[model samples]
Target: MILDAKQNEKPAKLTIKFNTDKGTIYLEVPCDIPDYGLQESIEKIIEAKCILDNNSNEGLNDLYIVEDKSGNLSIMTLTEYINYRKSIRQDILLLFNHD
Candidate 1:
């Protein structure tokens, strides 16, 4: 997955893109964020997904904690999680280079 965010005169926008068997999925989250907000936002996003998926332990591995809950679970592969993290980090670095 690739995550990128840019801030203009208006609200900041975060874009996350990942490839799947079906195709690539993209999500754009807009907010007014500062430099330090990236990590928190990323964590929150992942955690929310985990919760929404009823905390699937299958593919989470070391990325997050799996909890006991009732519902269907969809887990992200380790490689996908790692790639997502890398993308988030890259986006943060990009912010530093921006004016």
Candidate 2:
């Protein structure tokens, strides 16, 4: 079975909604990430954006509550997001590899 060019294309945009004291902040960026690396790539983009946007060192070390399009939430510090991704990957692997 062969998929058409349109069928082979993934969504090019990612929308990350951030709720702040000021109100909701929406970040829409180009995303061409593959399925296996999607979460990790999103986290990395968030971490970089947060670091660039924050004014203070303390803000750089803050924890973020990220919500997905489906309303699922995850809480993790910017510095620890990669580690969190690894743990999630391990859990997925264990689930699939279990006897």
Candidate 3:
């Protein structure tokens, strides 16, 4: 298999913004997040954190994901993007621990 220059470079990361009247959240996410359904995963995180957000962070329509590279966008509301981070971190740990 051969990959062209465009394909070789990973698609631009998706930026998850939790914009709200109170404040805003800015997060950059890798486009090719392995084994993780982007929208669904984010929704789960948001639902999980609904209770944790005692102060009501997410506004009526303030959470969305934007891809600068390809101009793709998705809407979701996750209080914390922990699942993705944990999955990627765990993978990294295993990769480096192989000694």
Residue-wise C-alpha lDDT for candidate 1, range 1-99, written one tens digit per residue: 234344334435565664433333333444544556555555645654544456445543332211113322223344755565687678867987995
Full ranking by lDDT: 2, 3, 1
> How high is the CA lDDT of each candidate model?
0.46, 0.53, 0.48
Candidate number with greatest TM-score? 2
lDDT of 3 by residue, 3-94 (tens): 44556533456665555444444545666755545665566446434533445534533333433234343333443234445666788679
Which portions of model 1 show Cα errors greater than 4 Å?
A: 1-74
Across 1-67, the per-residue lDDT of candidate 2 in tens digits comes to 3344657544465656665432333444446545745675467556545654663654543444444
Pitting candidate 2 against candidate 3, the one with the higher TM-score is 2
Clashing pairs in 1: none
Model 2 lDDT vs. the true structure? 0.53
TM for every model, in the order presented, reads: 0.28, 0.34, 0.31
Candidate 1 vs candidate 2, lDDT winner = 2
Per-structure clash totals for the candidates: 0, 0, 0
